[model samples]
Target: MGSAREALLDAAYEAIVAGDWTGARMADLAARAGVSRQTLYNEFGNRDQLVAALVLREAERFRALTGQAAREAPGDVGDATAAAVTAALTAALDNPLIKATLTDDTSGLLPYLTTRSAAIMDVFREDSIAIFTERWPEPAEHPEVRAEVGWISETAFRLVISHLIVATEPVETTSRHIAEVVRRLMRDLTTT
Candidate 1:
């Protein structure tokens, strides 16, 4: 049963990446998964639930990658944090799933991205903080440091997303600006 569920999810994810989500129906998803529509509902409840699951799954993957990058980043805490941000933001934007979600007008995924959802925001923050704590492990034990890092991470991520969706400038340039801000923030925080 679990295997079947996983298979369904894998197929659904592939369909999403392939741009099928734009006009994808439950029947299409089930057929692609080699499962019954009933099975899909049993596993994922409904289309909205399925979409939410996909978003959360991608978020987790991004978090893991960011955590690894944070651990491996070079230089001081500031440089390391900036590197992690670059890695995580680049990965998120480059991800096929996210690209589809953000760009596929037919998928209705933009609403999820644009709307304020506490559940989604919690996932984002938790995942971001996980990577951040790994980079600044000591900060994890300090409330003030944790709060500061959280603020920085959220701000940096928002800037990256804004650039991706709204800015005319290239991502690399926007990324550099974000990194510089993070570097400055880290320097100030660490110095004082």
Candidate 2:
């Protein structure tokens, strides 16, 4: 079996998906994970803590998937960025939690995933900064360049997420277009 912490979170996700956020009780969750209520509590204190862990775990899993997509694309920045974004947006459309976020407020936790996204933002910020610096290491040499790259990376990630939130077109088209935008931006940066 996996760690009790992961088992609890996995059960929690299943419960939330099968039912509602508020419906999953500590005892029920423990039963699903084959752990005691105290074990669940010890792993995650309370419902709020459990939810936070769930979201964080989901985010990290998404990030890993996204990184894999990016790596599989051609080494070029634009190609990788576009490919990663397309995969992420496509996956988000099918993701239960992310889909719940887009649909009204059924789960009672959409706001936590969307508007109240401090922890999520921090994850994206760090991931974006790392992606940028890795692709264009010259930025690492200068504080100003590093800041600018950081801004570009974070802004790009936000724009892609915003597109997901306000999805108007197909993932293929939007991600492709954004990739071009990124290419242009990075090209300009290299030229300057």
Candidate 3:
């Protein structure tokens, strides 16, 4: 993205972090970004799109970190999966936007964040698919194996998301358990 576009997104994110998305105006964002209102509109079209872009961008940042965790892990699949999932959960919990959207009962953005946030969802799903494929390329050659792993990755990611929002268990424990399940599933696919 151009500097102006990046600035606009950054300013919008700041507004969301402040829980002032409703109060945030094109003029405010433009001022924060050191751009004109026309420039902001030219980049994002409108506030809704700007918010969507912010969410997507933030989600992408988390996914990038998650992918890095996967890439940087040192041992086997279980260890690596644990690292990756833990990283994602940690980032989500730390991110102000995720915290605001998920934890704040009165957040006006909750409905849209939950129901219309396909871009955010895809960050986890697509990143998991890519990382799993990269780490276990042999499975991709088999259609059924690929499908099974995809399901496993999606389910594990959902568990991470749930743990982040609901917190039935400690994030570490839940992520570790999910990683074990994923490893077991992969072993079954290979052995049977």
Candidate 4:
């Protein structure tokens, strides 16, 4: 049953990544997962919920990857924090699902990505904050450090999304700028 659900989610995600979100009908998703439409509906409730679930799943994956990067990066807390932030942002922008969400303006995916919802921003914030706390352990005990980590993480995501969706700059340049911004933010946080 879990495998069936995961299969459905994977199908839906592939549809979205392929710029076929509009074509990702419930019947097609069910067929792709080798389940009936009734089963898909029973499992996911509706298309919006499915989309939210897919995005949330991807966000969690991104958080995990970022946490791993933080753990592996050899540096002080400040450098590790910056490296994690950069890695996460770069990975997100490079992800086919995320790129489709942010770049395909013809689709509603971008709006969905930024929309405020119980399953979207709220879940992302909670997960990311927890990951940041774990990654930057030095800041976990300090209110100031905690606040700075939260601010930097959120700001970095926002900047990256904006750059990808609205700005005309090349991706490499934007990524570099974001990395620098994160590094400076972390340096300041460590010093103050």
> Mind giving the per-residue lDDT tens digits that candidate 1 earns over 92-149?
6667877877777887776665564344556667656666566556666667766787
Q: Where's the lowest-lDDT run of ten residues in candidate 3?
A: 105-114
The 10-residue segment of model 1 with minimum total lDDT is 112-121
lDDT string, candidate 2, 1-192, tens digits: 359988999888887777555666799999998999999888888988888888888878778888788777776667778888988898898898777556736566666656766676676666666766676666677766676765677667777878988988999888888878777776676667
RMSD of each: 3.2, 2.5, 2.5, 3.6
Model 4 ranges off by over 4 Å: 117-149, 166-192
| C-alpha lDDT of all candidate models, in order | 0.70, 0.77, 0.77, 0.70
lDDT of 4 by residue, 25-134 (tens): 79998898899999899889998778777877886787677667766767554444555656766686678987787767765767655654334445446555665556
By lDDT, the candidates rank as 3, 2, 4, 1
Kindly list the per-residue Cα lDDT of model 3 for residues 23-123, writing each as its tens digit: 77799999999999999999989988887888788777877888889879977667778998888787777788887787556546665454675566667
What are the models' TM-scores?
Answer: 0.77, 0.85, 0.84, 0.73
RMSD of 4: 3.6
Question: Candidate 1, overall lDDT?
Answer: 0.70
Off by over 4 Å in 2: 184-192
lDDT of 2 at 119: 79
Which residue pairs collide in model 3, if any? none
